[model samples]
Target: MTAVQLPELPDLPGKRFPRRVPVRQILCLVPLLLVTVVAVRHRSVLAEGFGQLRTAEWPWLLVAVGATCLTWVAAAFTRQGAVVERLPRRRLLATQFAAGAANHLLPTGLGASAVNLRFMTVCGVPLARSSAALALYLLAEAVGRLGLLAALLVAFPDALRLGTLLPHGAVGPLFAAVGAVLVVAAGVLVFVRRLRTAVCSFLRTALGEARSVHARPARALALWGGSLAFPALQATGLAAVGLALGLPVPPVHMALAYLAATVAVALVPTPGGIGSVEAALIIALVAAGGPAAVATAVVLAYRIITVWLPLLPGALTLGALLRLKVI
Candidate 1:
């Protein structure tokens, strides 16, 4: 009954166990890193935006900023309205602001959608239901935007000169292109059994959710009202910027121009529609009878207030949310 003894190993000088970083800590840093990269990439734009703000009227600029803030609220409401279950009000609102930053970082609306999807899932929603809710929100938003644009066009037919915005005979080709894409998409959907089945299942789920939402009067109102207000607020922000910068276009005309420009460039895949939005907006304002220089200034200033100014704060919020495991 003898115990075996082993020799003790000497510790090597300057040798230490590597400190492991927590994955959560690393994830939190990811958002901040992304924010830094984005800010550096668009430094010139950010500088120009700040420079343009100097010439803007303080009162109107304040209105633009207010509208920008409210857009996040509207988005939060719309997101809530999409799902039947109630989400925490403050966290939902904060997520929208964070989503705004994410939207600017990713192409089209993917970033915002991703953030919302993650939030919904983290809040205990099923993945399929969250996806349906996201689709419903998008559909409602699109309809609201288009409906508002149509109403404005009817109210002020002369607000925008379509010919100035589009090249000669471009309309026919544009429609044809859209139709071709739709036809191709339809063909694929029809030919692929698995895809068609999946789409049908998704559609059924989305429709069910939509019906459930509409059945609740309060939810329905929030859904539609928020959807409509989101675009209106965005347009108002642009109009306010136009006024602040002394753009010659009327406020209503500027709103109309904003709606038109956004709709036209909705399909462009650029992150937050950055370049395309600026160019489209400038052309839209010019078509709405604004001087080219003033139109450019208005668009730049509007973007500054709406996008660049809040970006850092939004990014910080996103990082905090990640650290807290909110999404």
Candidate 2:
């Protein structure tokens, strides 16, 4: 609403940044429409799935929503905690919700992220400090995701099962899931430390180049970790959506999908990773061995629960934050 809090951000080396575009609600909604079309063409599947929803085990749905909400709330708390002087939980939560909306509506994933950093500045957080804090929050998120991936790999052998529908096609995804988890694990083991260093160094570089964006290395790491916890909590929400839809999908697969989808979309640079996330979700679900129809249903439902459901709250929060002069 207010002039976006974008001061020229410092440029960093080896950072593959996307060009920022004006936020376009229509562009963001297009993917939702595409998803609708894909979902509609599978009408019988929808009817079957929705019908199953009616008879669905209410316990699972309740638990799923609970977990989903908790995850984001945790995320809010995590970010709130990381600040030198804390932002109100309500404020953080509102920003997070608004960011989620922005992520969906803005194509480049940066829309919400960029907005938040600017908001932080508006809240009187210096650009360098706010930027570092959010970076740390993001780092934590990656760690949490990969940690879940490792747990799933070790704890659930067939974490990616494709219901009882297929003979053994599901096996491929099991391996794929394992492979994906292992890939992330290996990266963590080998590169995470270095990656942290790189991020810090990159921030320094960006600041040196752009002047406005800056963050201390240690603070950045801390904030990044804090930001990450919320993402880990999301597995419960995804699993819940599956349960609600009568998709016998595991929470682990949701974790895997979330990790894959989130990471993939971050790289995509589209606001909220719109097309990237939905498509990645479908692929991730399939990799987890969910039936095509079931994957479609669950992914759509998960997006609805996770993405759309929270938009209004976020928008309201964004407005409030602006009104209160908090960015």
Candidate 3:
């Protein structure tokens, strides 16, 4: 009776979506959720305080948003200035959006770098030009960060209470450890002939056999300058958020906290630094003179505007760009 009553199912395209399961996608999200929950718990108190901030001064929020927008604008233009390929401004912006989204989504910061390189290739930019542009951007990021750090040091000499913030007793030692590595690396690059030659060979192989352009000194400097503007603006933007939440913040403190957060999150290697960044930011804010509760609130609002809000638009752009083969 069962066989006699059988009715044929309509044929369908793509084999009825197949029975194969997607395992990597399911796996990909497990770590992200775990990290996000951990980061959130660390800031639970601050997040609770966020509800009260709904009635806080909002003019600063407006300024913060504007500043953040400008930072991305600077980033887009910086890349445009470095590459010889002449994509329209709109395309440059698209590339930045897509790259930023990927920056947060991918592991160990490699996704964004790949997306950036792909953008350059699609635009017919020679390999050297593309690589140099990114390298220029990185140099700028470093310069801006150091400048922020220096400002914080000068402005808050009394507040550089490093020992107070690192209760786990790692931040200070970690800082020293990095410095030690840097010194060793510099010594090798500067004095070791074998290492220097090896580095040159490596650069040549990866950047392709093409001769590096005799870069115009002014242009190269400008490239780095453009790179600095983004982070500088971003720090300012975060400071504006600080002001909005009624945190007692000075520009110097803002710069320092931002710089410290950047450095700290880079070490965590989480996708876009996630919970690690929020914790670093709150700690840095507290060290920079904010009360613990207010520091937490400020960090929450900071994440809201800078990380959470932009994620949606940036992600959509990433999908579009990938679909279009633009990056």
Candidate 4:
């Protein structure tokens, strides 16, 4: 009888065991799965959203589209203000557009930040200066947003019924989360000597840059004005959608709702605040007295114009920029 030969096992270059599954990839997918489930559960609202789109007023929708376009311009101007070195105008604008697309791929604002940081360095800014400029930009943006929110809340005293925005008992969890973050941050600063030194150096550089930018009136105006306008334009876009869909909320109230929702979801680390933003916007709109179905429709339409519509063109632009070595 011929000796039987077992087929050779598939090659394993170095290990004796098969490759392990990617736990990190699977963990990242969990949030996406949760978003899908939420979407499925609210399929009815989304269907209503489609119906609302069919009957949406063309002129108001057009205005919303324009506002969305202006957001990129606002971002570009703000970016220019962040650094003293002059950036190429057309390339800067293109980078802002591409940054918007990149934003949805990573948690919080990291993807956009990374893209802009790279663009600055490629434009001949030193790495230390670019990092400092990024920090300054973020600082200005946060301050502008908070200032706007305060102004809106004050001017439209009854615009939002706060209780509706935060359901009973949510305040406790929110406080707890904030406390945990503070504790962790303190621990890091205390224990991580290298990280602490780096952070201190970065902060000193950022402060110097901020002072220099503010000393120039035009740069100061561009930095603060564009930062303020960016959020206002975003809120206006939402208001335009509300108008297009015939939501009952007044423009001022709608703006208030937009500001509140965005601020509430700002700390959420999900990519572009995906699930948190939608939920917060819907809740805020309802609190502002729009019907739930109509509010849902408005959020869906707003996101389409601002986030999804520009995504493809922005992505193509990113690829072209990469090929040209512009970023």
Candidate 5:
């Protein structure tokens, strides 16, 4: 050891390792990156949407824009209605807007659900209660949509020609498929003891929350009213776009087509129902007696206003919220 004495290392007690990365700062950049990627991926769509806007009737387009804005308000209201505790109003609205952008990034509404769940948890709601509220919101929304569809179908018998969109033989198979899925799900729930127990616990919590929410008249009204208004506004935005583009379809028929198309593709695992939604809308519009070209134009313009135009700003808001630790 004396023959080959090793050099002593410098005494650096606190500087032995590199500093940790700023994870929060890195997280803040993620939303911007996602926005850029999405915008680039759909550049053609963005261009076409803008072109459609140029040729559209501004008055109706403005109406569509207004309807689109109201949707966020409606979503906020519905979210509030799902829980007994009051959430920060401004942050709730901002969350809904950010959730819209998130929804387009993930398939089957997972992005939106995740954002809202996180937000609720941050607002001091328990995870189980937050989940139950989410389920309640979904159930209310679905009921509102289907109820509106049925009412519209009854009011205007010829609004949607289902025969054209779905072959007579297809209906049976579709129902059977849905039934089979339900049965399989039920069987799994029954066979899995742990899962069944967890589900039962969740159900009890959900029922209790539902009762608490309903006990308050204002909360109940907001929940059901907002749920109904959200889909109505969505359909209205689509109808307004159809009018702006001079599609040869009545406004009522256009609304009917939108509701039908959306419901048909509700289970489709597409990000924001992008391709499937467009195709379904066009087909439904055609079935509703609109020209295919005009229907396509309307769908493009509608998507632009509702999804594309606000996407960047929404993503920016999401990043800001993350930096602030609001969700």
Candidate 6:
């Protein structure tokens, strides 16, 4: 005969209640909270921004929209450059659009990186190689953006004077914090042999992949050219918005301001750099000699055209791609 088991009794003298929290619920509400806070804090600015948008030049806004669209094409070209295998042209562009939606849902490009990684694997690229390609694409894009920024600085020395832009007191603390983090990271890598080995292997693969990609002139051109175009288009969109809002800053200065603001906020892990980017862009534009109210309006208009307007369609496309299993 089988015996039935009885439930165990609690050992505590009093009742023991579970204190578990809903972590997923908390996470879901965080972004909403941040958005609410930002909205309340900048309510007046947003009101003026909306007013400016209503009265803004339609032609310049249209140009900003066009530039925003071109960024997708640039992303597609950069993705094509990343791998030796040819990806379907239409699908590649669709993926970039979908990836943009994903990008705003997660921090520091994680969402886009995940989507692209999956796409590469679906296209029959090995995981290791795909990762290498991703690394190469990011490195190329960063270098291209910095190069563009440097060239602009050279061309317009007085446009965005860094000395006034960066706060005096923050520099030392920023460098110190960065140095401490690097030192700790280095210590961990030195102590953990397994992690060290894995990292070394990945680096080797990435270097080899980079070498092969550079050997092909077309691939090299596509990678660097697309990288350069992506940021240039982004800056153009900002500049167009500035024009639309009649910001006093010159077009070149606006472009430089865009580059400086974005580059500074790149390391921020906030989703789509929403809060941080808005703040940085406003500061940069103000430094570029645009009036505060006008700069706020330009940033809002640019974000609306580039981000909010496209978000829903991009999400729908993302769902379609997932259902079709093209990603």
Per-model CA lDDT versus the true structure: 0.93, 0.62, 0.69, 0.86, 0.93, 0.86
Which of the predicted structures, 3 or 6, would earn the higher lDDT when compared with the native?
A: 6
**lDDT for each residue of candidate 6 in 1-327, tens digit (9 for 90 to 100):** 999999998786887799898664454444445445545665775575567779899999999999999999999999889888888899989999988877876786897898899899999999999999999889988998999999999999999758767888989999999999999999999999999999999999999998888889898888999999999999999999999889999999999999999999999998788778889999999999988888888998888777666766776777677767787
The segments of candidate 6 whose C-alpha lies over 4 angstroms from its true place after superposition are: 1-51
- Each candidate: RMSD: 2.9, 14.8, 8.2, 8.0, 2.9, 7.4
Candidate 1 error regions (>4 Å): 1-21
Summed backbone clashes in each candidate are 0, 25, 0, 0, 0, 0
Q: Of the pair 2 and 6, which is ahead by TM-score? A: 6
> lDDT (0-100) at residue 12 of candidate 6?
68
**lDDT (Cα, tens digit) per residue for candidate 2, span 162-203:** 343234576698679979998997777577797767667768
Q: Which sections of candidate 3 miss by over 4 Å?
A: 1-53, 84-87, 167-199, 204-214
**Model 6 TM-score on a 0 to 1 scale:** 0.85
Q: Which residue window of length 10 is worst by lDDT in model 5?
A: 10-19
lDDT of 3 by residue, 156-216 (tens): 7875456555677787898899999999999989999999997776576434322232144
For model 5 the TM-score comes to 0.94
Candidate 1 lDDT tens digits, 1-327: 898999999977996889887987887677678778877988888788788899889999999999999999999999999999999999999999999998987898998999999999999989999999999999999999999999999999999998888889999999999999999999999999999999999999999999999999889988999999999999999999998989988899999999999999999999888889999999999999999988888888998888888878988888899889899
Off by over 4 Å in 2: 1-57, 157-228
What is the lDDT for 55 in model 6?
86
lDDT of 5 by residue, 232-324 (tens): 999999999998888988999999899999999999998889789999999999999998888888899999999988988988888889889
After TM-score superposition, what is the CA distance of residue 270 in candidate 5 from its true location, in Å? 1.0
Deviation of model 6 at 245, angstroms: 1.0
Q: All candidates' TM-scores?
A: 0.93, 0.62, 0.73, 0.84, 0.94, 0.85
In model 3, the worst 10-residue window by lDDT is 206-215
Off by over 4 Å in 5: 1-14
TM-score, predicted candidate 3 vs. hidden true structure: 0.73
Higher-ranked by TM-score: 1 or 5: 5
Q: Please give the ranking of all candidate structures by TM-score, highest first, separated by commas.
A: 5, 1, 6, 4, 3, 2
